[model samples]
Target: MTAHSRDTPQFYLTAPSPCPYLKGQFERKVFTHLVGENAAHLNDLLTHGGFRRSQTIAYRPACESCRACVSVRVRVDDFVWTKAFRRNRAINADLVGADVGANPTSEQYSLFRAYLDHRHSDGGMADMTVLDYASMVEDSHVRTRLTEYRRRGPDTAINGRGAGPLHAVALVDRLSDGLSLVYSFYDPEQRDRGLGTHVILDHVQRAKALGLPYLYLGYWVSGSNKMDYKRRFRPQEHLSPIGWTLLND
Candidate 1:
């Protein structure tokens, strides 16, 4: 049921399911639909409250005894590039991200499918079809964009956005407070290059360019090895009941 403004978010606990991040652990979530004209504003407030958006729904982990999921945001302007981070920047130097229309493409689907198969075979999205992927990208009611990542094509200068093969893609939401990384995936075979962290670093620069203070990296599950890299983005803020608290370096 819908509630009025100023009402605390109605929390719904999900039935037990296999945890996608930590094996042997069960997972649950508290969620609500993010519709209506206030969708964007609601998204901002919920984000600040440690909830993340997926299409029209916003959710936060509400597992019975798990405190693994923690909300994370990077201080874009103050982010100091480390030696490893700098090396990654040089490695994918030719890669450029272009914010394009939220429409899905066959190439994007192919990459997405491969990423799911290789990286998340047992996850919730293992069986998502092209139609589902399209809906995920285009079914948003807030400010959203698809940041297509590609190796700089020859005429990238003229086109502004590259026009060739897509190596990776991120569905992101642009908010008044910061850039939310809704979802992202890359070629799993390129794991050697650390494409995942590169995308986040790239978005931090993008956030800085837009004069936004933070890059909302979404939830970081403490027990999830895949999410541990989030800690590398120095000078970040993690939401706490007290307030947006600074994380220790």
Candidate 2:
């Protein structure tokens, strides 16, 4: 088949599985593969249209009666830095990061373990092994990157970035239209640091720096408190029945 043919995403339905976000209700998905020369472009379109990426698969909610998963994207140019976000930046100012290859390391695994232990102890990803983590980072067909955060050392002016052990990281996908945050984790012990918010804030900056227009922030379930924070990024666009609509505060 030609790239043009692949351009039209062929959708498929996933078998029903236990819902991660809700209880009692089963969840299903309508998905397509991100592959070939059209993968990047197709991914951009799908993501913009409310799909989320999982490895090489791009999927969206296709439940018969449920429609809870809402795709969210931050407006890079108009994003407002709230007081809390500003404070997070100040707190994590000492932490620095280095964007390494997608290859995973023992250090990253250790940090991942710590993050899971503290925050998601009984969560789905808690049982992930080193190999599983490696695949999570490396098994991708599109443009992907790993920005590992660390503490700044002396002579910071020389590097213009930090130099220390890894404390946090974000798995990012570089798309033609925007930056998609595939997953992120940070040192959970430093709750005072507000690293979670800081990472999202930092990515907004990164997207602006890269001249990207949006930052894909997965799903935002309205009733889910865990997702309410995503709305804090001002001038964000949420996928609606009519397409992406800018949410003004």
Clashes of each: 0, 1
What stretches of model 2 exceed 4 Å from their correct place? 1-9
Would you estimate the TM-scores of all the predictions?
0.93, 0.92
Q: Write the per-residue lDDT of candidate 2 for residues 1-249, one digit (tens) a residue.
A: 545565567889999887777777778999998877878778777887888888889999888767888899998898888788888899888877677868789988999999999888988899999999998888777888998887887865686556767778899999887899999998888878888888888889999999999999999976667778888888888889998898865
Model 1's alpha-carbon lDDT is: 0.88
Return the top candidate by TM-score.
1
> What is the per-residue lDDT of model 1 for residues 179-235, given as tens digits with 9 covering 90 to 100?
999999998888777889889999999999999999999888887888898888989
Report the CA-based lDDT of candidate 2 relative to the real structure: 0.85
Clashing pairs in 1: none
lDDT for each candidate structure: 0.88, 0.85
After the best TM-score superposition of candidate 1, give how far the Cα of residue 137 lies from its true spot, in angstroms.
0.7
